[model samples]
Target: MIAGISVAVAVLAGCGPLPELDGDPTAGKDGGAKSDSETGRGVNPLDNPDGTGPGLKVISSDKDRAKARDLIDKVATKGRGAKTGYDRDEFGYAWADSVDDVPWGRNGCDTRNDLLKRDGRDIKYRSGSNCVIASMTLYDPYTGKTIDWTKSKASEVQIDHVMPLSYDWQMGASRWSESKRKQIANDPLNLIPVDGSTNGSKSDSGPATWLPPRRDIRCSYAVRFAQVALKYDLPVTSADKAAMLEQCA
Candidate 1:
């Protein structure tokens, strides 16, 4: 009887194993991409679409989703059989540099810029700076709103965790190693750039409570949520499972 949308806990658990501050964070796989171009509308055009190309094939089947739901149920109740140690009360959380004691790179490609470059078409660098992207063109599938990804205006669009980090932390990520956390933070399986307003409205929430306002992308969003959680071994709350069954089915 896991209560609340609580998708954030699931999201944190999934990416928790990825070392948050890798020597080359951008070197890891990217999440947004497309399997094929159907009238130039079906491609996500990033790096990796949650370990697969962005297409109908990317969508999980009932069997895969059911497996994911089962895993979630196992760990969703917290206490006793919690999946990861990071979820324990004694577990301490810290930012990458402090926890790992690794020097940060000046020109390090961050997830934000990497995503901007990947999702933004004809992207422009903000300056001569290494990965400071300045502008891009975004085709919003959710509300049919077209946005220009510009340094000044692009904050309007934000990179959202299809599954949120905070939620995942509670599910089973609080006990992971530092390097693993970095990897979790940078994994392409858990991120998507969406409308800033929409993202804010959906902050750290899951299908049961917060979903994309635009009905068009709800199915896509649900599939992605399942994929990332399944990839990272995160658990889903009961409410989350029900929402996916109703919306993604």
Candidate 2:
């Protein structure tokens, strides 16, 4: 579960061994993207429909917020259900790339490294393997902190699920197919690499109960939650939907 970054215990859920890659990891991939700080401030969700784009940038414009609200309004809502029969394993072995219909799925690298490459710049890989990211400079949207993180202290940077799985279960995902669970679990659109401590604090919370500490990033965060909900045809709680709408308003 290298794709499975945790706030506590510092271990991926069901993490598998790192894969070995030939030649340069970025060589001839992603339109000849450089190894430097290539993804400037990230991409706005409104323009990044497929989520092949890197990073989650803030939604600042009035027009974008208007569009965000419109997008959010499409989300269905109901009161949350009981959290019975919920488990991490329900999401398909935590970030297994063997799953399909996802952006970076079966791309030879795991979901976690794919996201690290997508969001982090000034990247470095494990000694000989181009697939394992050893270190990178991450611009954490949640806390507005730039972390120069190394795999030696892998827990320092965590991949957060914008709409947490537990929250999803309480909403309606408990009944979804196993593949759908894995899709949401590893989808880049629903993932963000942020300060580990901040991610730890946000464990399984929705917009109503928790949001990014950085106020400016909240609207974008809200829009992302809505995007995930609508894309999966999942419903959010009514209170959660209200809080999400408030951030953009």
RMSD of each: 12.2, 10.3
Each candidate structure's TM-score, on Cα atoms with residue i matched to residue i, is 0.62, 0.84
Quote the positional error of residue 175 for candidate 2 in Å.
0.9
Per-residue C-alpha lDDT of model 2 across residues 162-226, encoded as one tens digit per residue: 99999888888999998889999999889988888878977887787787766666788888899
lDDT at position 46, candidate 1: 23
Residue 117 lDDT (model 2): 88
lDDT of 2 at 80: 84
Candidate 1: 10-residue stretch with minimal lDDT: 1-10
Poorly placed runs, candidate 2 (over 4 Å)? 1-39
Tens-place lDDT digits, model 1, residues 74-176 = 4333222233434322322311222232223123666666655545556677567767888866644433344676788866888776777766776666656
* Model 2 residue pairs with clashes: 1-4, 1-14, 1-15
Model 1: residue 186 alpha-carbon error in angstroms: 1.8
CA RMSD (A), model 2: 10.3
- Measured by TM-score, the strongest candidate is 2
Candidate 1 matches the true fold with a TM-score of: 0.62
The whole-model C-alpha lDDT of candidate 2 against the native structure comes to 0.79
Off by over 4 Å in 1: 1-107
